[model samples]
Target chain A: MPKIKYIEENGKEHVVEVPVGWSVMEGAVKNLIPGIDADCGGACACATCHVYVDPAWNAKMPPMGDMEETMLDFAQDREATSRLSCQLKVTEAMDGLVVRMPKSQH
Target chain B: MSEQIVIIGAGQAAVQAVTTLKAEGFAGSIIMVGDEAYPPYQRPPLSKAYLLGKLERERLFLKADSFYPEAHCQMLLGVSARAIDRKAMTVLLSDGSRKPYDKLLIATGTRVRQIQVPGAELPGVHYLRSIADVDRLSPEIVAGKKLAVVGGGYIGLEVAAVAQKRGLEVTVFEALDRLMARAVSPQLSAFYEQAHRAEGVQFCFKTGVEAFEGHGKVERLRAGGKLYPADLVLVGIGAIPNVELAKEAGLTCQDGIVVDRFCTSVSDPAIFAAGDCTRHHGHNGEEIRLECVQNAIDQAKHAALAMLGKPTPYREVPWFWSDQYDLKLQIAGLSRPGDQLVVRGDPATRKFAVFHLREGKVACVEAVNAAPEYIVGRKLIADGTPIAAARLADTAIPMKNIV
Candidate 1:
């Protein structure tokens, strides 16, 4: 299990252990953490699950796909570190990962 | 007396209704009755990821199994409401029990439209509506299998895409002139046809299925004076709203159970309807029945608010999306008649958007692999903002600056 930290727009923090092969958005949603709506239900079709990854943990993740990249263009306050949480699958190496939810998704 | 809300149907809208009620400080008891054995799960993945085996069964759930209990809600799974006694303010269940409610919500959703042609009862024939439907069809989606898909709508095309990707010989039959004729523009239909064709998915347009020819199971589909040998047949003509329950209860039913902007039944304020089972009047005065997750979620939100006495009108900008191979088709707003179609970006690259403008305002936008347009288009539709056609057509202009 990968321990993931999710920080919401309202300064709430949720630290939970996510099973492998589950997306970051799923980890948040399954744990009942608010702010990551995942409206398309992890299809990466909607950008509602936008999150900002801590730069230190960015390198451990896989490169963004075209669909995820295109969807990130719609996220509010997008940054180089902005990623759709639904596209980021959890792995053992991603332990201690921290993702900040965008205010727009809140 | 503090009231309990009894919701019929345990789909997306029903779950949202309960969640909204709890989130809005409603301490009343919430009872959800669903015919399906599983808790509320997302339906979009049934034809795509779930069928392809990329997603697991448990992942499809909108919330964990413990969610209902944690929310202080009671769920009557695998049991359906047999009757609604409006005067008695109670629901008769399939298990021969009655549940009383001060308020009622009908969110029974829609059922898959079955093909009435001969041999439709074959074993290999399937309809992609519920988890059980896909569970039966998933085992048949193997490599090199012949798949004959009936109907070219979203479900049909989506299943075709998944089958094609799984190395299956896929052929789609459409009664319409083009694919997705009722929902998308012709340009999109043409684009999808070309894309699917490139993926080796054959299409037979202007063709209607006469019957399914096989022995004890579907082996061939007879359509348009031709026999297509198929190992599996997936029917996706469309869905019919589950309005019979409402109608039986003497509620006003048209295309769906008629509801107002607040999602309250036009005939009875104490009874409300939401999601696919509702024919509601939008802020623009159009009576439309939408069958999308967005509508299900938002309409439930409004219905919960109204039930709590907040009474906010359900005026959400309609948006929809589809996933075919690498292309993501996103649509926002509703296209009205005589809308000027503006092309932004070239479709040759498969990253373009079609902006439908009515009365010089952005009425609707269909974006293929263009997410910015969809995001901006949804906001533009919601705000009713006008934009210059030339500016909208120019790809260089940032979508955020259009308004």
Candidate 2:
């Protein structure tokens, strides 16, 4: 399992050990963290799982797919560091990864 | 004593409501009653990836078993809500329990609209709305087995796609002239039909299912005076909201449990409704009853907020998606019959989007394997952004610059 840091929009922080094969969205959701909605359940069909990846850990993340990019545009307050958490699957390299929630999800 | 909140349904809406209540620091006891045996599970994947056996069964559950107790929510599974006693503010359950509630949330969702004809209750005849439904239906998707999918709607098309991929001989029998006639435009219907056909799925449009003619188990389907060989039959007609409890409790019922902007029942302030069971006002004063994950989750959030004494209006643009073969059709907002259709990309490329505009404003967009369009289209629909049709249709111009 890989440890991930999730930061809520209200400045609350939660650190959980996500299964390696699980998605970043699932990591937060399964831990009962109240940020990522993942309304589509990692299908990338909805943009409610938008999160701003930590600037330092951007290079370690999975490249955004066209579908993820498209859905990201639908997310509120999207930024350069923004990414759909569902697209980022947990791996050994993603340990200690930090992501911040948007003001609100779709 | 703290407030007693009872939620009559254990699906997406119930789980979301419980989550929101705990998150918002609501100090109360939450009780969830569901007819299903398992905890609150998602229905979207039941007809798609789960049906294909690609996704794990545990993934279907929205939350873990320990979550409810930690949130002070008691989930009463495998029990039916027999009645809602408004006078006593209590609910009678199938388990011979009467639980009193200060506030009640009706998230009973919907039941599969069964195909009414002879042999409908046959063992092999099935409807896909629950985890058990798919569990029983999954083993029937054997190679070389003939499958008759009724309705040609989202569930039907998704299942047909999965069955075809698993080597099942799939045939879709639609009562309408075109596939998904009620949901999508004619162009989209043609595109999806062509896609399914290319993948070896047969289509019988304008064919009404007269009956399921079989003995002990489903063997064949008779549609439009013709009998088709069907080793297993899937009825994907539609769903009917479970509103009898609300109606019996003296709540307004018009196609769905009628609720206000805050998801509170029109006649009872203490009773709120969400998900597919409730009809809420959507865009343009149009009352809509949506059966999708987006509506379930968003409306549940609204209902939970209102339960916490914060009534916020839910005005989310209704969005839905269906996966068939390689095409992922994503739709945002509602489109009318006379809305202008604009093509954003060439259909020949197998990746394109159709825009439905009302008075030159972006009303709805149906994107097939075109996420950029669907994503940006939702924003346009929500903002009511007036469009430049020429720029929108130009492949060179990005979606962000169109408005």
Candidate 3:
């Protein structure tokens, strides 16, 4: 399991280990972490599971697909490293991956 | 003393309200009443992944068993809410107890519309709505078995896809002329009709079921004045909103439990309703009752806010998805009249999108195996973005660039 770090907008920190093949959105949702609503359950249909990836881990992660890039535009206050956590699959190489939640997921 | 909040129906909307209320610092005593024996779970995959044996039963649950108790909420399982007492602010349950509340939420959702025909109650006849429904029909989904499907809507087509993959002889019966007639455009319907046929699934157009004929079990269906042999029958015609409780309670029930933009009941201030059981006005000033997960989750949040004394109008874009085989059909925005469609990619390629434009503004989008259009199209619908028809139809320009 790759341990992932999740930071909420309120500056709350939660470090949890996510099993391989599970999504980062699942990592937050299954562990009862607040912030990511994930209304679609990792379908990539709803962008409610929006997150800001750490810039350092951007190059090490899989390139954002056309769908993820387009869906990111739906999230509020999107940035350069904005990604839909549902599209980010957990991997051993992504150990210690850091993701920050937006102010809200509405 | 803390306030008392009561939520009826332990599904997507019910769970969402419980989680949101706690997250928003509501110290009220929450009581969730559900008729099912299991916890609240996701129902979308029940027709697709779970039916095909790709997903296990445990994955259907929306939350773990421990999550509910940890939130300090009361769970009333295997109990149906019989009626609502608006005057007393109490809910009458099947267990003969009146659960009083300071705030009440009616998230009863919808029930599968049972087909009223002869031999309908025979064994092997199933409807997929809850976890038990799928479990009951799981064993009959064997190879070489004839499966008769009623209705060509999303659930019917999705189950057909799964049955086809599992080596079942599947045939869909739709009263309409095409597949998913009410939900998708004619172009997309034709595409799916062909796609399913190519994958060895049969379809019956303009066919209406007359009866289900068999001895002690459903072995054939009488439709279009013809008898079709079958070992199993799946009814996916449609659903009726579970609004009898509200109707009996004297709440304004018009097609569903009528609510304001804040998701509060029109008849009472302390009562709220969400999900498929709600009939509320949209941002466009039109009345609508949505049945998808998007409405369930978002409207539940708004209802939670209203219960927390932070009432905000619930107005947002409507979106839905259907996964069949390797193809994903995503739709955004509501249906409208007098809208013209512009095809983005060729259907022959099996990767395309249809953009519905009304007065040069994007009204709705139907994307098949094309996620970018569905994702970007949602924003266009939300922003009311206007664009040239030629530009939208041109494959050379990317969806993001067009906006």
Interface RMSD of each: 1.4, 1.5, 2.0
Against the true structure, candidate 2 has what lDDT? 0.90
Taking all chains together, each candidate's TM-score versus the true structure is 0.97, 0.95, 0.94
What is the C-alpha local distance difference test score of each model? 0.90, 0.90, 0.90
Residue-level lDDT of model 3, residues B314-358, one tens digit each, is 878889999998788899987675689889999998899998998
* Candidate 1 wrongly placed segments (more than 4 Å): A104-106
Pitting candidate 2 against candidate 3, the one with the higher DockQ is 2
- TM-score of candidate 2 to 2 decimals: 0.95
> Regarding DockQ, does 1 or 3 come out ahead?
1
lDDT of 1 by residue, B1-403 (tens): 6688999999999999988887787877889999999999999989888988999999999988777887778999999999999999999999999999999999999998889999999989999999999999998999999999999999999999999999999999999899999898888889999999999999899999999988888899889888889999999998999998899999999989999899999988899999999999864679999989989989999999999999988888878889989888999888866789899988889999999988878889999988888888878887888788999998778887777
Tens-place lDDT digits, model 1, residues A1-106? 8899999888899999999999999999888888888888997777889999999998888899987886777677899899999999898999999999888872
lDDT of candidate 1?
A: 0.90
CAPRI grade of model 1: medium
Q: Best candidate, DockQ-wise? A: 1
Stretches > 4 Å off in candidate 3: A19-21, A52-66, A69-83, A88-98, A102-106
As for DockQ, the candidate ahead, 1 or 2, is: 1
lDDT string for model 2 (A20-106, tens) is 877898888878888788888878788788999999998888888878877776667878989989888889988899999988885
Instruction: Write model 3 residue lDDT over A10-74, tens digit each, in one string.
Output: 99999999888778988888788889988888777778999989998988778888767767766
